[model samples]
Target chain A: MITITGLSKSFQTPYGKVDALKNINLEIKQGDIFGVIGFSGAGKSTLIRCLNRLEEPDSGIIRIGEHEITSLNKSQLREVRKRIGMIFQHFNLFDSKTVFGNVAFPLEVAGLSKRQIKNRVEQLLELVELTDKTNAYPAQLSGGQKQRVGIARALANNPEVLLSDEATSALDPKTTYAILELLRNINRKLNLTIVLITHEMDVLRRICNNVAVIEDGEITEMGPVQELFLNPRTDTTRLFVQSDQDLQLNNYSI
Target chain B: MADDLLPLLIVALSETVYMVLLSTIMALALGLPLGITLVVTSKGHISEFSGLNNVLGTVVNIFRSFPFIILIVVLLPLSRFLVGTTLGSTAAVVPLAIGSAPFLARIIENSLKEVDKGKIEAALAMGAKSITTIWKVLIPEALPSLVRGITLAVITITGFTATAGAIGAGGLGSLAIRFGYMRYRDDVLFATVIVLVIMVQLVQWGGNFIAHRLESKHHIGM
Candidate 1:
């Protein structure tokens, strides 16, 4: 479980002070696939990045289970980060490394023996169904394969929380669903808590048990996907839901 | 004539190789850490020590601004102090290394800057420390470009060694200017130019090969 209270962050831009995130409060229960949906610049990225202290919050109390993440010093924060895996929209896999090597990186960082790293990486590859691509460089993999590598690498440390920063945004609709299904499967199998930020409503409707609608650094609506989709209170949520349907409708013959 | 020129050519070529190699080693030893520190300390970087970054930048700029020929002359006193006498290829190494270090630092800095920011972030997010990120991520990622930069530095230093030889530093450059040009031996001048060109070609070819190998390994996948 992760809880954030009074979280706020602002950046000093050339124009003026831009508040990237307002006084945000939220809770993500363990094993729940929680989605934070918003348009570009809606603070979805900032909010999730803040959860990992990748983008530090100006003032907040972020408790990931028992650890007060925001208050932890440099080394402690690193220790906490090992338990919280984060993936990016770009699938930020190390270019220099093979699929197996990328998966083994976190294990190496944790000071695991070579034997242990090999075993763990093998298991992760098997889990992600990329065991055959163990020797292949990231360049050799397709978009879907790359994301699977990203997912395998993320789970290397046995992290309790997985933060997805628009992980499927770069993929095609088919690839996007495949990745989302993978995420859903991982969440169920490992019972790992996932906090994913996306502008796509299909992402939310497909896997997210609960949803939060963010607009200009504030959460305008929050609830289960069924409730939010059945009745969206805010125009932002309505727009996102409508756009996702329009996209899907376009793909269909009817 | 060929027999007489052969031994002199051999000696001068050895001296040129010796001067360039020693000074390049020195330059790399000094410049690599300085360059890494410069990048890591700059604004929005991993270390983020802007004051140190600016100060180092100014220092590197101050050294890099001086032309190699002028720098060799100006650094004579320091070279004399360090290497005991400033007359030969050995003494020439000091000024050459000093002149090249700053330039190499800038080259290395640029190469490091080209490393994907996402790789560094990924390393950091994986609980790797800043120093680890530099060694394990930044350096390896920038390696091919850095190798190319070293090749450029070596070629530059080879050219500079010729200038050093003009100051009585025994090498092909001195042989060219003295027994070749001054003595009106056009054959010696032609031979030395050919050797220098060949040396440059070899360095460039080797550097490109290594850089290409590294590039193929990653193929800019990130």
Candidate 2:
């Protein structure tokens, strides 16, 4: 459902030019939960941002469904963006808007009538189990509930692809598990193509079927999650798998 | 003499209100868009146009740095051209609005800047156009602060109105100078000062009330 070829991005810092993503290529199948795992500064964030053209790549080709996202003009890209929903680590909700207002934002942008927007927003809220909090503002909700609003808002347009940018990073482990479960349920229910990036091995293990290890702007390992977990190839992948095991051991000891 | 004082004070107070209120409306009309433009066109913003941003910034700065008294003199012809005379409270509004507009713009820019960048990115990611984001996200999020800033602008313009009275614009300031200083009627000056204080207090109180109400609704989430 999504394909990228020779993607590259660099930032000109005061010190010098630093490569954020260097010649990255990947493919994600429809209805698959694809995960990119990397440490901070490993460029995973940049990689996912490029998928939606939120962060413009210095050079690359990004294809989502039939649209070549990188080649689209401003207006064309905006039209295509309606089909690609993105959620952030911070939830990025509008503080001024209530849950219903937040979820209805995309519908409003899509130019739906007031009745259609209310109906669609209600449906989306039910999907994310936030129906009870419709009129509540984001600050009034807990972290998990806010994330639920984010999920509902992301799904408002019935997007074909859902991009999660460390969406659960800010939550506690218990909350993270529940949010991931929600994402899994969403993926299954909608058959949506999911692309997520994270620094946590547990996050990938919990939901991602296919995982890629990124290091210093390059993908060092890519394969099925189980295969990579059982027989890791690179030092970074091995460290990640080892850490996941260590976490399990600590849980057992506790 | 004492019987005539009440009517004269009433007229002067009304003129002060007229000049302040009209100029404020004009300032808002001119300044809001200028402020939005300053924010939207800056480097790395939604529609990043650094050249236009710098030029506009410089113009706003230049206008802002001019003293109000100098601004009145400098804008004399504009006031005359705009209102057909440069001596009355109506003519004074031309310089007053022009003087306050850039100051209000800076305040508005600061308030808008206080909105979270992440919220803007979220708006863009959802396929919202720049105009939609500005109207829906930036302006709404900064509304409370904008109110507070406008309160300050209105108070500043009120002070300018008094100064405008010095030159012949009929208001409390001219009333004080003409009667209290020239005619040696300290009672007239005292009355004018009291009225001006009451007006400013009402403006501040009203601004705070509205801003607090908005903040309760919008900022509780932050």
Candidate 3:
């Protein structure tokens, strides 16, 4: 569960100031598969980074299950990070590490013993169905396999909230569907709260329970995924849902 | 003529080999980190310490811009402190390492900068520290470039070592200077130049082969 109030971020450039995010407020409930959809530079990435305090907001109150993570110092924030995992679009497995090592790095950082870490990494690999590829380097894996390793590594600490920043954008459609399915299974199995950041509405339709539309650093629409489709308010949301020409012509139902 | 020339040539060859080998090792050991540091301390890279980058770049350029002949003179004291004398095979390596480390660093930094930032961002997203991302994603992905950078630096250092021999450091260059430049022995000079050229060619060929091996591995993986 996470809550944000009056968040704004402005960056200084040589010419003038640039506003990346402007006055955003939202609340994410426990066990919710929330998708934030926006075009490039809609500030979706920055917004999600703020949730885990990876990127600091100039003014905002971020409450991660009542801890107010925005106020924590570096060590305290790092502790909080252990409970909130993140995956990337490029499946950022450590190129230098074996798949097993990549998945176990978090466990190692958490100071687990060799036995405990091996056991946990093995369990994680099994969850992502990457057991056979344990010794393979990230460079050796296909795009889909790389993503599986990323997911396994994210789940290493048994994080309650998993943030996915365009995690499937770089993959093929088949791989995308499989990764989404994996996320759904993880959500059901662990009751984990997942926050997916993407620019694709099709992705929201596939896995998100709750969907939010962001435009020019503002949240224009947000509600139950099914409901948002039926009562799409913004031009952005309509374009997102009806992205396929045939879908727009057919008038999609919830 | 053959018997008289054999021992001297053999000794000269040994001296040249020692100079090249020691200087290359020193250059690699000291240069790789300097390059990594240049990348890390750059804006928006691993460490993102721009002030450090500026200071380091300035220092590197200052040393690099000075002529090699000047560098040997300037570093004479440092060479003595390091090797207790600045006129032998061992003594010359100090100048070679110091002179080329920064040049190699620049090459390394440029090479590392060519690695995909997308990969690095992904590592960071997974909660990796700055060091992990650097050593893991950045360095490995940049390996091919690093090999090329190292090759360039090594060749550059070889040239510097030969130039350093003018200050009395022993190598084929020193032998050539002694017999050919000072004593006016055209035969010794001709042979020395030919050997140095061949040695450089071999190094270049070896470096290119290794760089290709690394590049192909990366290509196959991707």
Best by TM-score: 2
- Model 1 Cα lDDT, one tens digit per residue, A1-254: 89999999999999999998898999999999999999899999999989878787999899998999999999999898888888889988887788888888888888999999999999999998988899999988999999999899889999999999999999998999999999999999999999999988888889999998998999899999999888989998888878877888888956
DockQ-derived CAPRI band for the predicted complex in model 1: medium
Cα RMSD over interface residues, candidate 2:
2.1
Candidate 3 wrongly placed segments (more than 4 Å): A248-254, B181-186, B208-222
What tens digits encode model 1's per-residue C-alpha lDDT throughout B67-133?
Answer: 8889998999998999899899899999989999999999999999998787788778888889878
Off by over 4 Å in 1: B220-222
Q: Candidate 2 residues A153-240, lDDT tens each?
A: 9888989999999999999999999999999999999999999999999999999999989999999999899998999999999998
B65-120: candidate 2 lDDT, tens digit per residue: 99999999999999889899999899999999999999999999999988888899
DockQ of each: 0.59, 0.63, 0.37
Lowest-scoring 10 consecutive residues by lDDT in candidate 1 chain B?
B1-10
Best by lDDT: 2
Model 1 chain A poorest ten-residue lDDT run: A245-254
Error of 1 at A207 (Å): 0.7
**Worst ten-residue run, lDDT, model 3 chain A?**
A245-254
